[model samples]
Target: MAKKQTKDQALANNRRASFNYLIGETYEAGIQLTGTEIKSVRLGQITIGDAYVTIRNGQAYLNNANISPYKQGNQFNSDPLRRRKLLLHKREIAALDEAVMQGGKTIVPLRVYLVKGFAKILIAIGTGKKNYDKRQTIKERDMQRELGKNLKNYH
Candidate 1:
């Protein structure tokens, strides 16, 4: 039997999001991009490290996600740091807005990928970790690394 292939192709990842926040529910969102932006994205010239999601006037926008200008797109390139609309359902946007209004919850983009030739981003609800929580996370990571090494040596 032949194995099925996954159509989603990852373009960019926000590795720090996991380390900096306690992630909760996740959502898949579509990004509204211009011609040059899509071209840049196809070439993997995108960064979401400093990107975040915000809802305003019943709409969700992706802010601070940087997409480098296409080399051949002179006079047609959009601003790299301009906020882009996130194509989500009204109910989803309302839910996210509600979640964000509570305590320290926030919406953060985790990764950008392509699905069926269309760009998609994975976003999640997260709470900012305290300094002590960050330290604990680091310690746990170190312990896991050490344990993996010990297991390898034992085997």
Candidate 2:
């Protein structure tokens, strides 16, 4: 018999975010999406690789996140690259705003997933990584992969 799978699952992940930045604190923010957009998300038609979070007018906005147009949406589908609003508390927005103001720090989306039928994004404070830092990340990742392979062979 097949077991029922959990409805909560990741729709998109920013794999490059970790390689490109030094991540700090993280927060979960709700995303405001249209009906078609939500439909596309549930189908895993989303990309958040180059997406980032920004604060303006005391509100947080998600930029560069692409939610592809639904196949049957036709004219009902909105722009795939349109800026989406992120729902967060005033204090949370203020904290993110303050972190950005500290200079050299920015907010980036780590991943997007569904929670109770609603889309939620995991955002974090990040500082840009230097070229050398990126190289170190690559080295560490390779080492981890090699170690995992060795352990499997040992077993």
lDDT of each: 0.93, 0.92
Can you tell me which runs of candidate 1 are displaced by over 4 Å? 1-8
Look at candidate 1 and tell me the lDDT of residue 52. 97
What TM-score would each prediction reach against the true structure? 0.93, 0.92
All-Cα superposition RMSD per candidate: 3.2, 2.3
Inter-residue clash pairs, candidate 2: none
Q: Write the per-residue lDDT of candidate 1 for residues 115-146, one digit (tens) a residue.
A: 76678999999999999999999999999999
What is the lDDT, from 0 to 100, of the residue 82 in candidate 1?
A: 97
> Which sections of candidate 2 miss by over 4 Å?
1-8
**Cα deviation of 79, candidate 2, in Å:** 0.7
lDDT, residue 20, candidate 1: 95
